[model samples]
Target chain A: MKQEFNITVFSENHIGLLARITIVFTRRKINIESLTVSESAISGVYKFTIVIKTTEDQVKKVVSQIEKIVDVLKAFYHTNQELIYQEIALYKVPTDALYDSDQIENIVRNSGARILEITREFTVIEKTGHKEETQALFEQLNQFKVMQFIRSGRVALTRDPIERLSEFLKERDAFLNSMD
Target chain B: MNKEPMKVTGSEAVILSLLEEGVEIIFGYPGGAIMPIYDALYDYDKKITHILTRHEQGAAHAAEGYAKITGKAGVCFATSGPGATNLITGIADAMIDSIPMVCITGQVASPLLGTDAFQESDVLGISMPVTKWNYQITTPEEIPDAIAQAFFIAQSGRPGPVLLDITKDAQFGELEFSYKKCKKIRSYVPETPVDPFKVKAAAELIDNAKKPMLLFGQGVIISKAEEELKAFIEKTGIPAAWTLLGLSALPTEHPLNVGMLGMHGNYGPNVKTNEADLIIAVGMRFDDRVTGKVSAYARDAKIVHLDIDHAEINKIIKADVAVLGDAKKSLKMLTDNCKKNEHKKWLSEFNKAYDTEFEKVIDKDLHPTKEGLTMGEVISKVSEATNHEAILVTDVGQHQMVAARYFKFKHSRSLVTSGGLGTMGYGLPASMGAQLAAPDRTVVAVIGDGGFQMTIQELGTIAQNKLPVKIVLLNNNFLGMVRQWQQLFFEKRYSFTELINPDFLMITKGFGINGQKVTSRENLDAAVKEMMDHDGPYLLEVVVEKEDNVFPMVPSGASVSHILLEP
Candidate 1:
């Protein structure tokens, strides 16, 4: 089945890399559901989270191509399942919904939504989850009327805790253990 | 006296003993003082494959590349003094990553010791900080035992590079012929089983801590305890954060993973490490890079340090509980005794902060609008195609940071980079070695144009053997990393940073390999795909924008909070 794979890239931050990164998806005719880039902790590093529709093989190709970029240090692709995928959806719900009833508050709490800014006129609710979950929450809020709905692209990580360098270190540990 | 050890020199014994250890290959070059070993190698030409590297450094890195992929001890030989010193960077690289390798170097005659004799150096001292163990063979009789011990130590606990420096006189001296079985070195005992009390205490801490974080290090990966870590995380419901060198300990796509920690780590994990009530540090030393400011790091958390090498304990940050044992064993015990604790409130808050921060960085101007390509775009495209599975070997400088920043390694041993040593001219040879070890897997070497020329001589080695390696040259016509430093710290002087190079395409073609030049993003995907599809070696020159700087950089000796953001 054709599925959406979100590629989260952490690389040296620079200009026009986004257009270049998007070019690959566009050229391959893979639909980019969403894409975003941000500054990382390291001054030179930038993190990119992009959602695209394609098969595993296609995603693999896209990832390899992404890795070849001269400025890029690492490119990682995450499927919906393989990653702790999350996207932020900002919704401006009607102000009446916040004060008039407890229904919106209950729904927001259950969905783990945070009220970023509130006023007598409007309420800004932020929800972060799997893209689907975020979308579903946004859809549910449609009944109450949404002033604005925006979502950041999905960023993900594997469930496994062992890191690449740590694995190498652990190998030595195992070798030493066996020696003992 | 036993017919002078059957009429062989110390170097000969070194080679003979390696054969006994089943070393089918040795990467080295003939040099002064080490000629005796080369002579012995000639006799065993048919029995072993000897690859002649352009430099001693190349030999060491190749050995590391080989060992990393095959899980076997990689052997490299170098002559004494300069030869030995040249291999220091690679040696340190292996030490930091804990790759199993044995480096044999020829030393000056014992009489010439401390005399600064021609081509003579105190190799044992020079390599002390970078190696797990080192030995200087003073007598021919001890050659066999020393080499055996070297191999054993290199392949043993937390496998790391071991150095054996044999004096020239020792190599020439006559000794009795006998292969003696090795007994354990009395002084070199590594920690084994976890103390049950400490293990139980650690488990209890994990079971009760409201907010917990696990810091996985290179030690866990070297221990091959990925499954153990996964199981433990699942059982105890702990979130994980790793160091830059610890990229492969857990799959980058794992749910509980908070991404690479420390100064450049993801927001949630880096901050969470400070906020957690209990921090489980496994198989990792508290390097300055990871700890930032020790006083402020994990201030509220109780640290549990687990390691196989006891010496590492209390070397950096003090642990609340130090469990001296293999990480796998300790983690296993902890998992058996621990109960899952929910940190929903903590995790939720962290997730929100992480998302907000991540979005802000990516939403800004990150792409190059000018005619030339930016390093990030090129790397992102390459990563998009490779899916983070290829073995990435990198040369030092801006390209190294660029590659580390962009590449996502999902499996252990997937990325072979010079971390501690940060050696230039490392990418090509390292990639060749990694490819040789994992012939079926893709191996990519990302190097800056300046760094590329430093070891470009290896192009002959790669072409002659037709190794399937993809060399990506990030050409900006300058020593990008140093130049960046000059710009940031030295007032943008740009001293001796410029580089002039032969056409990479033409040069690669001269070596009878495929080559291409990519100027725009439009040409990047196709050009890289072509190289990936090529049957033999391929070189791609990516013309990146000059004067590009990596942001969020923590200036030297500056606090982690003092990050240099791009304007």
Candidate 2:
């Protein structure tokens, strides 16, 4: 029952918060597949996107623990079906392979990849796709003497219309108002 | 409410902020990195009293003790590197036990950070996992805000330790100082709203349950809901059992109070947990020690969990009705919704189990027929001598379990021990803090020989301050708890559990403290009396049976119902 789970957390921009969030997973012995942090759409707020393969029970617990951080505003976990996600990958290939034949060009076109730059030593190709698609392109280009390959961590957005963080903040503010 | 700000050094600003928060005493040690703050402290001796503990670890535990008794955040100070690292144990201890503590550690100058400078350490990174919240202040302007947030986070909601690592440059920097207490943080909400629907559902379950049982923890004391808990129990006439940290929430003599609940808890509470139809857990997590095997623990029972932290709700055992909020408000709401009734038949069942346990374990432990003094007998005598009103601070070991079981509590916050962390060497310094918090109340520290050695230097602090803290050293000549496990599960290898020799009386005498050593039962009463009757600090070392073990133990991974009275 273990499958890919992407956890998204929204928090105030604070120092040492990333360490606090990672320690939750570390303490539980859950390995992080990929992690990415950046400023969200909201001002003074940051978003953390983490990918891991764990059971539903474990993912729920981990998400709850993440939300328990002092600066974290909200946390949510989603499966593949609920998220629209992609990873950007770059492949470096020997320029000689391109000069030898048009096969590499055909492969890149078929894989929906674009050549970013070409030099005497190397040709750089960039692709934005799912992990499997990126890996498939890498395998196909491996025969062309691909010198290097790198992929960014998964960046995702929920399929739902409304931002979950906005809704959470509204409810939180309402609660604070009710307390008064 | 506007006031003119005063210009001062950053170190002075730190003291002014603490004074604004009404901090009277600080447990700390001075070091090169923190010398600036100590220098500023030199002039404010009358406004704030600083007790210089021998080690940073002792200061941490002393702060924990102070916090637990006063229901406020405890404050401790340490320098960078080794001084800050020494406080890691105390910080982790406070984290697990939910004791509110604000730990301030000095760091190298801002420019020296990450440069491998002398006495520099990444205290923020080192303390990240253990602290509830932490921040590093490199500028004097951040001092007031950081300290304000530290206290707010430490004492609010599910209380835990918080650390502030201030660089040396910040301490030396000058700025305009104004103190403002933090009332709220937009990202962090300390109180969870009590859901009426959940409260109704829980009350309905309690009303319909034929045999309902209540399990309370330190949350009861934290929320100051002892009276509410008592009223709830009285309304339902349900049997109540307490966790180790919840020992003093209810008077031991309460009619409905059953006993303790955990690995070495009273037999009735552990055995009856599985039998109860509905388990209303108030402010207590179902720790592994309390629930031996989660799969087999209370399989047929419906659990109603009340807590302030939402993460603890279904982390272990799922709750059929989870009322998430302060226990005081939740208990009151549930009590209002429930009907008045009595479960005498169920109550008698607990009495029956208690009778069996008392006959098999309690009788023999409390009233030994043969040989050396039992830990249980000594604890019982100390309880009697203090009239059960003294605050009992204990270190981790078999002695902690014995003291928790035998000591009778008549008031709240009477028991202070490292329940979640089980930190050794906690009692000696913790007793100092407890004594300082409540000057009129007698503070007795029950420590094992092994644990006593862990923080014995605290004796110098007690001597210098002339703090009246009674120290009861239960010397079994071994690390009894681990040895008990070794004897039962590890085939009695007794590896490194046995200690060599030390003249405890001589050690106390060197520290300028009165002491006595009792070897025979004939002199036990008089020795306890003399120690309790003494005006200043005193240590009473009683040699206990070497091979004795705590009974009614549920072996690891075993069902609570399968608890063993004898190996």
Candidate 3:
């Protein structure tokens, strides 16, 4: 089935290298939902996470092509079901409605929200949860006047228990030594 | 045997001349080709503080921040090709904001210039549109004069970015270095004042019109004529509205100052701009955001444009009387010649509209019992705590609008945000640069959680330098601006508007910077005070209402007259 897949790649940083990665998806007609760059544990390395909707074969080919890039060291592909991810949404509703109804409060508690501020006319709220849960909350809250909204691209780590970078690096070095 | 004067490269002459100009700081990095200039830098007196940035882009931004805060030409240097190209965004950022800065880049040797030499890029050609002036120095003798002229152009007129590209060979070759006082520049003649006849015509229009509105732009602030603008508006009792770049030109609390007048502007400002019979626009280009669907904007109004740049006059919107001159000089002349008329009825209507709209968004009693804080409340508390005096720099997003809407900046260049470029990751780096320039002044980077994370790598730069810049992370956990679009235009399909962030507190703590999370308004004051009290760099992760939106929005593709205040 065609589904959305968020692929997070860990690699070294190079100039204009993201363009190369995105071009692969673009040429394949894969629409990227969101993309972000961050630093990784190893010095001089960067992590890129991109959300795209495509089939398994297409993702595999894309990952293989990405791995072939000079600076890309590792590519991790995670389907929506396999990985746990959270997103944030910000909304600005009318301030006058704050005291009139508890509707806003009910929405907050159900969404696992934390109230960030209170002013005379408006309130600012923050919520973090799974993508579906966050979207559900936005849908529920959209009836109120909205001023602006934005999301940080998803950042993820493996949920399963695994050795960290230090141990992984050591093991990889030992394997290379054995091969030598 | 006869002795002669010692010789030095053109690049060396430029450096020596810059030092003579009393430039105490040069933010840059070293690379191939420009090694000669770096060599010369060692022989000079240690008055100039050379900061080695991780990237050339950072150098340019730092220079921009320095210039913004100090009101002087900030200098940055880069080597050819990639380095020059990297500086392009920062150059463009400064250009859009009308900042005074001079960027010097090393080009590949003149002979190998067009041969696609290893690091050679046609930087001057690429930077022409984004710079006030740009030149590639081919000869050794032109270095001193070019350097002098670059500073002059950058600091004078409307104040924009300038670039000087010198060939690598020029840096290696030797020449006698001398400084000559600049008599005058012929090609670059900035407007002095508007024609007195045109000023009289503008005054007559203002006097005769029943509904007169003033549209101010960044030119007023750059010209240091805020007082003159206030006088003109106050004397005429004319209502005024601001553009994004015009935010610093008028005080937020001024009786006639109707905040920003554009797509995301205050309702009253946009309404008045639409309803006015006469509009006196000064120092601002009618940016598309300000005049959405231009055919409908101020269609019935008589438009008078006063700008220092002749090219900007009638560039986008036609002007009834185009007065090409310094904004200050032109406004002063207009005020001097015009008779004072109090538009009491018009002012009352504008005031009523302002209050009605202000009450909706700026009510202090409204409490967000919801999951997140509202963007309005975040800005309200930020301005309240800082008294709106801190150097408030913001990355592009919903947060930029919130700050512009709420923050009351009293000084010129007080509020710095990406206006024309709207670049993300601009806030943190630009704030870092600002704090470096104004070390003692309180500087804050107000960025959305999404925008904050974009350039958070700059935290390393902040931590490394120990610069005390307060960062307010409005953590809504969503790409708040895009989500607004998804809600309004995309029908809440919400394809991917989420961000799961690492615990910001832990993240800040790992960097050894002070970090605090304010979950409620009760905690906000304390957290801000604690962060301010702790000293060094501080990150205040303000978890605001996720669903909160900026109000009085002119719906996308709509005219300034059509605004959506609420659902």
Top of the candidates by lDDT: 2
lDDT of 2 by residue, B1-567 (tens): 124798899999999889988898999998999999999999999999999999999999999999999999999999999999999999999999999999999999999999999999899999999999999999999999899999999999999999999999999999988888887888899888799999999999999999899999999999999999999999999999999999999999998999999899989999899999999999999999888988989877999999998899899999999999999999999999999999999999999998999999999999999888999999999999999999999999899999998999899999999989889999999998999899899999999999999999999999999999999999999999999999999999998999985999999999999989999999999999999899999999999999999988999999998988878
> Candidate 3 lDDT, tens digit per residue, B169-213?
877777877776443443234444469999998989998989999
lDDT by residue (A1-180, candidate 3, tens digit) is 678887877665644467667766766788898787888767776888898988876676677556534345567688877777777766666766667799988888877887787787777777777667767777777778655555667876667676244454565455445533
Candidate 2 stretches with Cα past 4 Å from truth are A177-180
- List ranges where model 3 is wrong by over 4 Å: A1-180, B1-6, B43-45, B181-183, B364-371
Candidate 1 DockQ category? Answer: incorrect
Q: Using lDDT as the measure, name the better of candidate 2 and candidate 3.
A: 2
Please list, in the order the candidates appear, how each scores on TM-score for chain B only. 0.90, 0.99, 0.94
- Which ranking of candidates, highest lDDT first? 2, 3, 1
Q: What share of the true interface contacts does each candidate keep?
A: 0.00, 0.72, 0.00
- Judged by DockQ cut-offs, the docking class of candidate 3 is incorrect
What's the C-alpha lDDT at position A126 in model 1? Answer: 93
lDDT of 2 at B498: 95
